[model samples]
Target chain A: MSNLAGWGHYPIVATECLPERGPVDIAGLVSAHPSMIARGHGRAYGDAAIGQPFTLPTLGLNRLRSFDAATGLLRVEAGVSIAEVLATFVPRGYFLAVVPGTKFVTVGGAIAADVHGKNHHRDGGFADSVEAFRLVTPGAETVTCSRTVNKELFAATTGGMGLTGVIVEATLRLRAIETGWLKQQTHIAADLDAAIAALEATAASTYSVAWIDCLARGNALGRSLIYAAEHASAQEFELLSNGRTAFPPARSARLAPPLVAPSWLLNRASVGAFNALYFGRGVARAGAPELVHWDTYFFPLDAIGHWNRIYGRRGFVQHQCVIPLETARGVLAEILDRVARRGSVSFLAVLKQLGPSHGLMSFPMRGYTLAMDFPMTDTLLPFLDEIDALVADAGGRLYLAKDARQSRATFEAGYPGLAAFRELRCHTGADRHFASHLSARLGI
Target chain B: MSDQKTVLILGGSSDIGYATALRYAEGGWRVWLAARDLASAQRNADDVTARSGQPVTVHALDVLQSEKFVDFVAQMPALPDTVISVIGELGDQKRAETDSSYAAMIMRTNFEAPSQLLDIFAGRFQARGTGTIVGVSSVAGDRGRGSNYFYGAAKAGFSQYLSGLRNRMSLAGKVRVVTVKPGFVRTRMTAHLKLPASLTVTPDRVASDIYGAAEENGREVIYVAKRFWLVMTIICLLPEPLFKRLKL
Candidate 1:
């Protein structure tokens, strides 16, 4: 509600008390009310976590009742945040092996979305880390699913959009960390080709990613800075001064003027000028020694706070596509060239090196992932249609989480395992009512 | 168009209402852009679908046509998860002097018909324990002004109704109630009005913000340009005697 930004502000039904503190009978409450959506952390940008009738904020379900430090096993309530897990367990020399960009996400939400991170090429998604979970379905039946028991439900719940059941608690594996530092090397590529070359050459390392300048065109269409890291030992951390709170803390909750600018203000001319300044400001930047802290290295966007407002009132869409390694160079070059020609103003564009897919419903493959922000506008639909065709032609697909305006037709056309997902939804036979609340346009 | 989520817009083709249709279509949501006039709503639907490359269906959903509402609700392939009422008229305070009819129409447009539709949906929402409802009020409802108290009164009444609806739905599961109180919006409705830089908000910005809020339940009663919140704060803090005398 800050400024005149046109955002939908629904009345959040406040459950000031925890689920345990409240009724203590989840089945009774759900049976009495069928339209409830189990929400975790309120982090989902769209409606996957929200349904038509209710949003069940499950972040409050957090409780770490059991942890077997010897086995590297922990059973936690679905609401417990990943940060809390690390805070409690890291001192015991354990952490989530596979984590997304932000530590603010809850374990349940992470599992439901099957979220991945920069280390995805090495570790895969959160589902890979989990062992078992207690699931409560719409029929008010609670079932514990694991690799052995209810195996189909276990796989279905992973990236299942919370349609099948509600997660109460789960057991997951944790990795041992030393000195909380990454033995890292940074390579600065002068142009797109060099960046691609650098990543391709070094992605075999335990940890690897590339941040490319998406606005760069022509000879520099894919200029990038690459980082490959390994878990640092105490000696390496000491040698490089790599451990603990290294970066200057960013200012959070800094109030910016929330004024609505005329539509002309964000048109191509102004955006082009901004792009010119941004693209010109950088050429090739290099190494920053052994990096530390999970926060700074991964979730840089989370540091900025409500960063989406930077696109102003019309908000922005994050479009990500991954083209296979065989076509990565061509697809990336063409995409950047088109963006430059269109004078697209995206302050943040991320490029990551991906590896082969793990299984069914997996988003990653041995390819290059390029993510760029585009201001939501009247022209965006057609513009994206052009981009989608190009990505499709290049054997690439879009990410579902960040999507706002894609048709189900487009999604089915793009994503490889979409048919399998549809069949799963069919077999589940639950009244499919997933809220995108973003736009009623998706044919879901 | 026929496959669209049927929306029964009471006012139908009002600027903000039509703008909402565009927002719906842009997101690939098939829209039933209902208006008082079937032709006007259909035309607006055509315009929105053509522009957004999404589907739009038109329906006659006149507040005056209350008897049709039940049949309308039952006829839908599914009960809509959302309903938006963007009906308002900044009735001149001077008109209240000569005619109660104009004032009543403004009141009913701003408050009554919306309340009736909401009463129906609220029951459905409570019965189902889910659904979202949106009522577009104005910053005019924040504090009554000497300039437009007649219209402001209606909006204020509508705002309170939404607040009550929100309270009722709070325990009724996830029946979301959104009360939009935008400030100076640059739509056809305000074509002739003078607006401050901080007050004016674009249709696209409004649509996107509203879409984001609805998508995420970020806020209720979102002021289009967040600056309006501060502006309203300053206005709210003004001394009573001094505020009443202002030409503004």
Candidate 2:
């Protein structure tokens, strides 16, 4: 047994770590271990991937099976990382129709979490692009699942946190692109109203996201900078003589911390200074348009490897939630007001607009979602609990992929389809054979 | 002509061998997996085919059954471009000290079976003028220790056999032979022990290192984790008087 933790690195658990490089190994592991969950790149922010006694790591099973150029369909193993897909197809004028903030996650994890990206308002969640997948059940059976076939299992497995079965492989539809660059436009919002107005103004863009200054007070409260982008077309790349045939853009080398830093390094004083500089820079660059690499525009934080270490050895909690569009402004204002009153400093605060929800347990709704990261502290849990109550009252639910702490009542109340989801789990025999710490904690 | 290649793994069900087989299959090689249990090997073959979109063939070959060696070679669909020998047994040192049969089993499994199989292929490759052989030895052969010296002795014998094979094959034809020594690999064989985190490596690292060495001709021996070469050099250089008193 080895000690393992999720991306957040909080509440470390001791479990038998099985490194599976193939479906046969996964089948053997599932049969050997009663309570086990499939882990891919360990990117889910909490205990969702950490079972009670077993964590079957799928990293070694990574392989690209096949690709249909005419249809833009790709068949890849469950452990294949998004970074691998991008490296193989980005230069060939293809891209993942939906991408999360990080490229380090695996296909299995993306489906299990049903993660949404900055383009959620237009592209939906990760499960939307998946055509079909193979699931290895605890009984050592490989079942093919798709929207039309094994409909209940398909619904339960998506956003099911690997409870339904171990994802073996998946076939996905890739979107064609003219180039590997994004044509980006930026706008500055002075306050909460201006920020929402900016989002509304650029709602038609294929991709839109905002960096909010969560600690801003009074008139500057909820100040943000919204970035909206579209895939660069041939005319947008007119600088290159060959237009659409221009060379693919190269990503800059990544940077990483040499070692873990002292826990006291990222306190309120330091974060406050950084936020001020960011806000000032945003104001100065209002309405600025630039052409950036797809990697830069979609995965900004990926430039710094193991950037989570900057949060210190104690790790950090990422709080992400979505509220109904009707109550978005009021709910967000209340949440920000509480954070300012508590003097909590979040160095990373982001906001995005979500489209209609698809997966049964998917986090998104027709609303606005905001995410923030705060270093774990004594008062952080209570503060988050308070925010959760506010979100639940507004009919908003917390994102399972990014949650490390949330009460059962809060989760159950937020997701109205929990009963149907439970029935599916029971029908699939997942309730007894597969379980994780998060599932046990929430009575799932 | 198509740029196609084929590789045969002697102990394909082993963790290290299976990982290496996956690497070869992913690189567009038709992999033939030979092991004691044909059913289990077929399952792994199916998995590799699914992952790589390449065909994989499974064969039954118990290393102890030397009498059937010639039949196994004759049944091959085509002469493999490369054949990897990843056969070994870590018999209990304590048991080996008491029973001669235990020690014999360890020696036969690690040294005799691999050497006999390679010798057969060596003759065919010498006549054909093209082939490669990868012998997976171990760093335990660098110096004798009370803990697992029997297993080490077998690997040391295999390493010497590979050295002789490389010399003769180089003089006769283009046939190449490479020996691999991996230290503290995380596999089912070492699952029961508590190993230091910094010193242990995954099977994938071993697979890539083997692939890299085979890609370049004239390479003789490869330390899976390259740092192991230096570590072994220091151990091998230690004075006999000082080394004999210490427990590893």
Candidate 3:
């Protein structure tokens, strides 16, 4: 057994990991290990993919099955990562319809989490682009699930957190683009009211996201800089350029922390200072339209490889929650206030607007979602519990994909569809065969 | 048109051979995996076909059967543009020291069989006027060692044959030959040995080096890790008296 952790690298768990090489291997593993969970890239940030005795790792099964240039439909193994997809297809005038903040996430993990991106408000979650998928169930049967076939299984498996089955292969409908660049505009908001106003003002943009200064207090509380963008069309490039433009060549990560940083280096003072400088820089770039590469605009954190090491050996927790649009500003302001009051500084704080949730356990709602990362400490669990209570009161759900320490009561209160999900799981016999640390802890 | 490149891999059941097959397949080359065990080669061919989305076929060919070698070449559907011979046996040193037959078998497996096969291909490739040949030798062949001198001697003979082939192929201008010398590699052959992680390289590394050598025109010899060239050079420079006195 080896110790494996999620992208957060927090709460490391010891489990026997099965390295699955292909579809046959995945089916064999499911039959051999009664208790197992399929882990894809381990980007879920918590215990959802962690299981005892067996964590089926799908990295080895990555392969491109087929592609139709005309329809833009691509079939790939579940283990193929977003990074690989972007590298292979972007230059060919295609892009993933939905992409999470990190490109390192595998297609299966993204589906399991039903991950959202900046364009979620416009294009919906990752599952919206998936046409069909092949899943290996607990009984070692490979079944095809899609909207037309096995509709209920389709809903349950997507955002099911690997509880229903192991996703072996998936077919995705890719979006065609003129170029791999975005025409971006930034808006600086001084306080909670201005941030809400900014989000409302830029609702027309196809892609929009906000970087909040979580430590800002008093009049400056909930200060944020919003980024709004859309793909640069060929006509726009023609008008702007001399008719000689080429797609931006994808750049690989060139920098990575060779070793873990000292924990004390990420304390309140240092993080606060960095937040100030970042906000100031964003404000300086406000109102100017800049053409930026999609990789740089969508996945800024990816430029620095092994960035989790910056949080030190103890790792960190990312608490993300979405509240109704009406109470979004008030709930987010209070959440930030509580985090500031606790002096638990977060190095990265992001706020994004989400459209309607697609699956039974999809994290998004037609509202605002705020995600923040805080280094692990003795006071973190209690602080999170308080935040969870406030979110529950506001009728918001804590994202299961990002939860490491959520209580069973909190989970029950958050997901109203839990009963239906459980019924489906029971009907499919997943309750008896499939289980994860999060499932067992939440009493699902 | 670029996807029409064909590469034939002998001893395709070996870890290094399978890795090379996958590498070539990924490069848009149709691959033929020829090994003694048809089942194992077919499995590897299937893996490459899946991973690279390229065509791969398996054929049965036992290198020990010299009489069948001619028929093996005749039976192939089409001659490959490039051929890679990755056949070797790391025979038991202790057994070789005690039994002369074991030493002869070691020489036969590592040297005679592969060179005889290559001797046939060398003529066909020269006549075709456009082909690349890669033979994987070993760094142990640089200088004789008491531990595995029989294996070393066989590899040394193989390397000498490669050097002559490289010279002959270079004169033809269209044909090229490359000799690959890999350091300590962590394959099934050395799985039981407690090899230092720092010193032991993976089969993937060796495969990439071989692929790289073929990519460049008229590239003669490749030390898998470039640093091995320097190490082997220094070891060869040591006086015979000093080298014989020290145990390697």
Candidate 4:
């Protein structure tokens, strides 16, 4: 349920794990269902955590089997949540080094997807922080893999997106922290160039990202909210909220009318109004370093649970593409120009800097990636293709992990690693059970 | 990704293929711009790098020489994510009708060559249990409008091939397949057509949506201007007797 995306609605199968306090028989389950799609807390934004026929639920498998608090080392089953890790150890002054957008994700999912965050520009993808993990391949064989052990599988499986096998247990590195709070600063950029400059200037100063207004045409084509932050000291965190038990309240969803409404109901007229409402709600000031909690700073959307329902029933498509930073300005301009030309209205768009990825099949490159969402519509393909070509000309690559409709030709042309990744798949003679609808659609 | 995750677009000089090459190059994988004219592929590669800041290599490829495709794949550091078939419609339907050679040329480029290259790509992708295949099939294939069904019929055959290839690849794992069914795209291919404002969509918009469908979601059959989906659906589902009676 947590991994559902706007592309399609599908049933979620549960994963299996031994509860920390359970008298469970691991051997029995392992023998019964040797081949399974292992999942953690199922917090993946896309299909990274779910499988169709058989899923190995790992949330209940929560248990920090071992931890050397002194050395910043932690050994946990694949199901341990980032929140749980922070709650259990942060009090004692330690934290997970690299966290994705949501702490709800499991330790295993993080390693499998090699998730990246705003700090990725400096820290690299999550795979950079991983110590090692236990993987159950499709052949029902379990092996511990790392940079040196089963190296090809290790590299491929890092960002392999669960295609290589299922992750059962993992040992991840922990970040020593003074508090669970973050020192955050937000700045507003006038346009795409200014926004990109702001991102570049502060990139080395701190973790950076910008929330762009995709529908902004002409001068404000890529207006953005640039944010940078570092972990706040424990004393500062304590003083900011006066040690409140919970985080900030979330913005409730203004639910739509209904599903299956006529597609015309969400046309440019409605979208234009929506865009105005979105853009007019921003703050003009900048430079105040607000003290914030881990959840608020990192997983802001998680607070507003089930936000996808806001799109109604047609669901939506998350279109994200990475263009080389050099051509980002021109490519983005052309893309936005085209979007405006086509009158495709989108409420919010985010543009961020992506450094080279460290994982084998990692998505981010040394470029700028922009993600925009629009309700599924009839004109989606041609409109999307126009931008697709722009990004391609800019030497951009699309992220496979998040794609729903990119064609096989575009993907093959976009990701040269597809064949290499496929080559690795050839060696592993497991059933084709590791595939996904996206993979099937793209012929991957 | 030792397979180079590299793409060598055959139509490097053309708009669609060139755009796709840049997209891949920017995403971090190396790109090989393969065009009939090696110089154009190189210039496109240089321009791609200038825009993307990622390295793009250029190669000489001739789809007409099907025998060279195997050799091309053999020399490639890796097989491409896909080989786009965006080279067609040079031979006008009316002209092709008057000249059999012109008609044969369109068929060879639109269907025969794509079939050859995909056969090679599909075999490799199937064995590996992972690969994506996309072919830009036009909405013209929806029905032989007195306008251009020769090219349309060729795209129709290519779309069918994609489905069959996808079925075969699914046995290994699954081959992601997307056959873009675009309406009157405003490209040089349809430059002469007095395209209706309502039916035409720009290249970037098509590229954006196609990129979305191909990379993010993997929608199997995407009508670029989604309205074309409805338009085509009605057209496909129209009463056959009544439709033929009107000479549409």
TM-scores for candidates 1 onward, in order: 0.57, 0.86, 0.85, 0.56
Model 2: per-residue Cα lDDT at residue A183: 80
Angstrom error at residue B36, model 4: 72
lDDT (tens digit, per residue) of candidate 4 on A182-245: 7788888888889989889878844777887666778887777887888876566666656564
Candidate 4 per-residue lDDT over residues B1-248, each given as its tens digit: 35556554556766566667657765665777667767555655754564454677777778778878889778876767755555555568789889988888888788778777777877887777667777777777777666566787887787788778777766668767667777777665655568778878876566666567767876778887778778888888878777776554
Please list the C-alpha lDDT of all candidates, in the order they appear: 0.67, 0.85, 0.85, 0.68
Give TM-score values for chain A, per-prediction. Answer: 0.83, 0.96, 0.97, 0.84
* Best-to-worst DockQ order: 3, 2, 1, 4
Write candidate 3's Cα lDDT for B168-232 as tens digits.
77787778888999888988677657776666788999988888888744467888767778988
Q: Rank the candidates by TM-score, best first.
A: 2, 3, 1, 4
Q: Tell me the spans in candidate 4 whose CA falls farther than 4 Å from its real position.
A: A1-36, A39-56, A234-282, A430-433, B1-248
Docking class of 3: incorrect
The DockQ value obtained for model 2 is 0.17
Cα lDDT of model 1 by residue, B117-221, tens digit: 777877887788767788888888888888877788888899999999888888667888888877888765676678886679876677666666665665777
Deviation from native of the Cα of residue B102 in model 3, angstroms: 13
lDDT of 1 by residue, A208-284 (tens): 77776655677767666677777676667667773353222322434443654444566565755665554444322
Q: Each candidate's interface RMSD, rounded to one decimal?
A: 25.2, 5.5, 5.1, 23.1
lDDT value, candidate 4, whole model: 0.68
User: Can you write out model 2's per-residue Cα lDDT over B33-70, one digit (the tens) per residue?
Assistant: 99996755665676577556678888889998899898
Candidate 1: RMSD over Cα atoms?
A: 19.4
Q: Which stretches of candidate 3 lie over 4 Å from their true place?
A: A238-245, B1-72, B75-78, B86-117, B138-164, B167-174, B184-208, B231-248
User: For residues A217-251, what per-residue lDDT tens digits would candidate 2 score against the true structure?
Assistant: 88888989999998888678675334344436446
